[model samples]
Target: MNISWQGVFPALTTKFTAEGTLDHAAFKHNLQAQLEAGVDGIILGGSLGEASTLTVVEKEELVERAVNLLEGKVPVVLNIAEGSTREAVRIAEHAAELGASGLMLLPPMRYKADDRETAEYFKTIARSTELPIMIYNNPIDYKIEVTLDMFEELLQFENIQAVKESTRDVSNVTRLRNRFGDRIKILCGVDTLAVEELVMGADGWVAGLVCAFPRETVAIYRLVKAGRLDEARTLFRWFLPLLELDLHPKLVQYIKLAEVHTGLGTEHVRAPRLPLVGAERERVEQIITDALAVRPQLPDYLAL
Candidate 1:
């Protein structure tokens, strides 16, 4: 299960039952879909996966189930988004023990850590686990940007091998390349800018919309990498509206609704988060419905 640190890795939405329990059946259904569609890896318990609402035991269950299900076809990456260094470390250590192939580590949650604190938070976790880590450098949402200076300090840790570049600035990809070269792999974290980032030399996509449309997502990545931009752009254009849903505050509900339409999942989100309702639900549904009505006939991208 060695991660190649390249290609589409779905920051999957955790499936739950109506009573608010982990829906093992639905979760496995989507995981199989992702694998069958040729995703490079599976990232569990991410922001898109509703990490804040999931219990520690539930997260561990997800890791164990994914490990057993994928069985090494692709790496199972558990995301650590804890508020404290100690809690983050504990989660990282447990993920390693549970056979997670790697970790997607966010900066200190809740309290906005400064540059020094953020670097130390990452360094402590990197030292605590043998598993490789992908720094979730999403300053726009998380508010703590891992600057190039911070990365310069953190790069001494060999395990800090990649980054989820979600700053929404596509140019940052080239900046990262210019600054660090091949030392750290860059995976575009924003769905809308995925192709642009990849074109600018990003190594992979840590995608959100891929949870519902796995084949299209994987096809776009392969097409871009294979130098088939025309076909990729055509498919991506069709996917744009659906992909934009990932940018919303209620993205979990929106994506799960898309999943339901595709029969990949249910719209059963955890509490503090409700399923989309009324005009909002209709709006999101129309977008998904419109996209599905004319879903593109993908090329033989697997053969590419």
Candidate 2:
């Protein structure tokens, strides 16, 4: 595919069977749904996919499957940034080998590095491959923050490319635009902040919970891109609560439950991460059901 990637790139769930093994068929089925929902691309193994917990091999399979299934339809952006630069490069190389259109990486977590150190980390990883790279700024969960100045410095790398802004500060997107203009592609990583981000000039959104309701997510983005904020805001109202779940610590579990409730994918998470429990599970179920009750179902091809 020779497409310039854009629009709602919904991070998909890696559906597993009851036996707990990766269900390739279920995953492909979900991919077809996102394609039908009008997304410009699919981001496999993102935060919402519990990607941090997945083994390198498992993530490889997920990206390979997505590329094989949707290669000609949409660009598949892969997120497989491990804690170290070496591991992150290995994953990025592996994904590029499997034909991923772009690489989405996170800051090296664990150690709090200064601006120069952080820039070195990103620059090293980008130098590892030729694929266009997009940085993921998700300070809330990763315990790491990328300052606007740090980002400005990182942009010096030609391959540093785009950014998935999840900082929750909408002005950051505008600030990025003011500094980089069209040089950098700004994607709204925080779903609730999507409308404002786009209104401020973001190119797209990498919605994690949107896997369960991609049609609504893409519809809002398309409307916004068309300068129809009046309609976009109305559609966003329907997705705000669902968007908040991505902010939850148990975002993966909540998103998986929402997918299951809507018959989009299975909710079987890996071990060490217990399946929901007590009031947590009950509360999640109620929220999932309530969200789905009002959501307009995505069309057949978008519904796996």
Computed on alpha carbons, the lDDT of every model, listed in order, comes to: 0.94, 0.79
Per-residue C-alpha lDDT of model 2 across residues 199-255, encoded as one tens digit per residue: 888898888877887778878888887777777787788778888888887788888
In model 1, which runs have C-alpha deviations exceeding 4 angstroms? none
What is the TM-score of each predicted model, taking all chains together?
Answer: 0.99, 0.92
Give the per-residue lDDT of model 1 (tens digit) for 1-304: 5677999999999999889999999999999999999999989999999999988999999999999999889999999999989999999998988999999999989999889899999999999998989999999898999999999999999999999999999999999999999999999999999999999999999999999999999999999999999988999999999999999889999999999999999999888999889999899999999999998888999898
Span of 10 residues, lowest total lDDT, candidate 2: 295-304
Global Cα lDDT for candidate 2: 0.79
Clashing pairs in model 2, backbone N/Cα/C closer than 3 A: none
Clashes of 1: 0
